[model samples]
Target: MARILLADDDEATRDLVKRALETDGHTVSITQDGAEALDTLTSAAATFDVLVSDVHMPGLDGVALAKRAIAAAPDLKLLLMSGFAEELDRAQALKSANLGVIIKPFTLDQIRAAVRALLA
Candidate 1:
């Protein structure tokens, strides 16, 4: 199973995504804020196969966190999720950051598919 760090400011959405990922045989670590998510990635003992984070959040946001995570672990895989379609345009901005993104309001199937594709 892949270890996934799930960061979302919304508790319900985080829980839902966590459950879905876990159900798909992924080990998920849930974080409520971007700062905490970045902390986990920067920690010396931190370990995660992939990161799934919301685009908008307090104290850093997913893009910033992804940048930091990539610096910390260049081989790390990232999956960013956002409710804003405008953020998709920023995908190019993340090219050097080494990350993939998904628009919000996505289905469990979509998430699972993304995860599978990344893991593959």
Candidate 2:
């Protein structure tokens, strides 16, 4: 099982994702914003295998968090989620070879596959 850090401003969405990932046997740590997510990624005693974050957080959007998180945890696998077209485009423009974008309204299997792709 993989250790995961998940961030999303929406409480319901965060909870749903946490549960879904946990049900898949991944250990997940959840945060409400990118700043918190970054803090956890940089300060956690244990290393996370994946970072799944929403792109529209209030402080430190997902893309920015990904930048800092990669510096803090170079091996981190990143998967970003966004419902907006503009945000998705921004994520794509990032063009990091290790970055993956999971469009909103995606199935749980899609999320699992995205992370697996990065990890693989």
Candidate 3:
């Protein structure tokens, strides 16, 4: 089980992901946007094992959030989601052993698998 921080603008997506991960026994904390997610991360007393975020958001985007999240917690694992090819490409620069990207409209299994891979 892992502690997961999930951020997305869409309520359905957020709920879907939170439930999906929670079913796997992970403790999930959700946020509506990148800015809120970052705030939660920085303020959290306990460290989260993973961050699952949507690439696009109102206040701050996932890519920027990822960068700051890593700086705040170097060991944190990241999974960035986006439907746009360009947005996915932008995240590629941040790719590493601890980072991954998932195309949006993903099946529940796909997202679960992606997070599992990061945890692994």
- Full candidate order by lDDT, most accurate first: 3, 2, 1
Query: Per-residue lDDT for 5-108 in model 2, tens only?
Result: 99999998888788788887999999999988888887848689899999999979998998888788777888999999899888888777778999898887
Candidate 2's C-alpha runs over 4 A off are none
List pairs with backbone clashes in candidate 2.
none
The local lDDT score (0 to 100) that residue 63 gets in candidate 2 is 88
What is the TM-score of candidate 3? Answer: 0.96
**lDDT of residue 42 for candidate 2:** 79
Clashing residue pairs, candidate 1?
none
Residue pairs in steric clash, candidate 3? none
Model 3: lDDT of residue 63: 96
TM for every model, in the order presented, reads 0.93, 0.92, 0.96
Q: How well does candidate 3 score on lDDT at residue 109?
A: 91
lDDT of each: 0.85, 0.87, 0.92
* Segments of candidate 3 deviating more than 4 angstroms: none
Task: Name the candidate, 1 or 2, with the larger lDDT value.
Answer: 2
Q: Which stretches of candidate 1 lie above 4 Å from their native place? A: 96-98
**TM-score quality measure for candidate 2:** 0.92
